[model samples]
Target chain A: METPTYNTAFAELEELVAQIEDKDIQLDTLAEKVKRAKELIKYCEEKLRGIERDIEEVG
Target chain B: MPTPKKLSELVNEIDATIRNRFVGQAFWIKAEITDVKKQPDKRWCFLKFIEKDRNLITTEMGGVFWSNSYNQMENFEAATRQQFASGLEITCLVKVVFHKRFGMRLEVMEIDFAYEVGKLENERKQILERLVKEGIAVNPEGSSRYYTQNNTLEMPMVFERIALIASANTDGYRDFRKVIENNKYGYHFSVTDFSTQIQGDAASALIVERLHSIYKLKEQFDIVVIVRGGGSDTDFKSFNDFELAKAVALFPVPILTGIGHDRNTSITDLMARQHKTPTEVATFVIDYNGDFENAVMQLHDRILVTSERLIDRARRSLDTYKRIIASSSPETIMNRGFAIIRSNGKIVVDAKDIAVGAEIETIMKQDTILSTVTQKQDNGNTNI
Candidate 1:
């Protein structure tokens, strides 16, 4: 699967948080939701900090 | 042509005639100081003054401040808190002198500091009025379309790409780079510094050109920042240019300004999101990204807490269902002194359905007995 953008990752994390808070969510899907949430958080943190060291100067 | 006058004699004649008109007479004159140079002796100040006609310098004159006059001017500056520098509009009392060698020049006698300040204030007010009339200034009723256009743009979750406009070797640019590069969060910024003249005659045009270039590559940048280090009020005058202000106001991307003047807001400052200094602008970017990071951190905590709670809830529910099922098992019921009777391959539920001498099976928890029924019982009466 392709990596999600920061906004997409954040949105997914929020949805996962909401689903986990839901009382009607099935136990079978609980683990799946938690795993996905963790993945999104990692993707977001990497996107936030990942960049080259030098600043590019334009005219 | 008359008498073929000598060059020196004609020059002397002209000087006498000019002196006849201006000698020993003082008049108050209003003009801008285009340049000022202090002599090595520290007692004399030479200045070039110019009269501007609608942004064009139409006339020029030289002026001198002798030691006695310079001392008086210093006292005036101390009282009025305004410095005599280039780009200052001043009304000074001067006596015109036609020198034998240096030609015509004004001799400084006194300065009207209050008048200069009032003139600047008037000019600022006029510019503000023009901006309002042009429908570009912030509306008092909170409905200015142009002033609020760039403000309505959503800041990116992470400021990955930034378009920075500042002089190449300025303290402001250095300070901004230092703060952003050394942010404690380790956030990375892809800064593209568009070095340009930050202040001076060419500053406004250069800044406007940079803005256009950024607009062409607008998608490549997240935000545009214009910053400058501390300078005199004259140096900041370029920021008040109408063209630069208009460009910033109508910029497609969000523009932030840190021109480093805390007292008065420049036209560019009014058009863009203004900060006190370049460092503050960098701090704003850092804090902007930090907010999203903090939010993500909060969400991470929530997910962890909620997942654990959910798993614990599911476990307790499963345990309860398991207990209920175990308690109602057939073996458990049968172990409590009950027997299940079977006849003709089916459990007999009613006694009337079976006749005497019928073959049957009695099943208990540990044993099953094959027997024949010799009696039929109904409600406390037995028939054999």
Candidate 2:
């Protein structure tokens, strides 16, 4: 699978928050959902922090 | 018709008559240059001068810049940074000379620098007017100079991939690279150089070609940047080209110009999405990325805070349920001074539930006691 973009990661975070806020969520998976949300947040934060990209030259 | 004169004799007579009338005379005249060529291994140049009525050439004359006067041509180019080539209009001092074989020619003496500059300025005005008339740009009003389709394009939210149009040798290109590479925010971008000449007569065509190349792969770029080193005002002449300006104005992707002039804005600059010095353009990109990062970080913070609040609320709710369950236990109720009476195997809550002679067990927090029901009492209350 392709790596998620920052926008996509943020979107996933929002969805997770919705699930967490809803009373219908099972308590059994609450911790697991929170952990996944934190992971997505980290992924987005890393993307923002700079990674070097190759500089290409063309005619 | 009358006794035909020999060709040489007629030419000599004509030349003598020409010299007799205008010998040792110099005149300042306005003419357009054409077919200019420098003699090989010699400090002399030959060219043609023409006078035009509208676009039609009315008169033409051969002209020369002798070795002694060549420095004047050099000085003109130095001052204007414009090529002293064909199509250039100049007010120049010339001496009319006539020879039997060469016929009539003018020896160029001096060129008017201000006149050439004025001509260029006039052309610039015409180009700007044409752009507005053609609906390519809005008429600049007040402080706003240009409003074009390209300028109206929305910049990408993140400038990660860039198509860079600039000469590889220019200091502007180096400065831009240094700034972007060393940015404090460490925002990295994929800059692809579409190297091309940034000045001279052919620069506009080369740049326009580069823009075309970028168009083919438009999806790969977030924006296109054009930059050149700082130089004389005339050094930025190509950027004022109408064709280049039109290309920039109509480009599908946003373009940025950093031609390095503070006093004058080129037509390309007016049409582009942003115009700044090379270093400043780099800085702007960095800042743009920084802003996006800040927004993302803020969103991260919000999500973190909200999720924590949700988990904390869940925990508190669980704690409340635990307390309620513990407090509602039978032992807890009995500890608060209530006894549970059991008849046989069931708890008795009403006087009618027990017979007059039935045996009962009373359960309390600390002890259980066996007892017998001696009588039945009638009371209005029946609910336990």
Task: Work out the iRMS of candidate 1.
Answer: 16.7
For model 1 the local lDDT of residue B43 reads 78
Predicted candidate 2 versus true structure: per-residue lDDT over B1-384, tens digit per residue: 699989999888888888888888899999899999977369899999998889999999999999988978877876665667898888999999987777789999999988877877788889988999999999657755789999999888899998999999778899888898999987888999999988778999999999999999999999899988655445567988999999999999998888886766778888885556899899988999999999988987786666556545544544443344345445566889988787887766667778888999988888999988787766657875
Give the per-residue lDDT digits (tens) of candidate 2, residues A1-59. Answer: 25887578767766776776676665445557666766765665455443211111110
DockQ of structure 1 = 0.02
Error of 1 at A30 (Å): 30
Interface RMSD of each: 16.7, 15.3
After superposing candidate 1, which stretches have Cα over 4 Å from the reference? A1-59, B1-27, B32-44, B49-61, B66-89, B95-105, B141-146, B231-233, B377-384
Considering the two chains of model 1, state its CAPRI-style docking category.
incorrect
Chain B only, TM-score of each candidate:
0.79, 0.73
Please give the CA lDDT of all the candidate structures. Answer: 0.77, 0.80
Compare the candidates by lDDT and give the number of the best one: 2
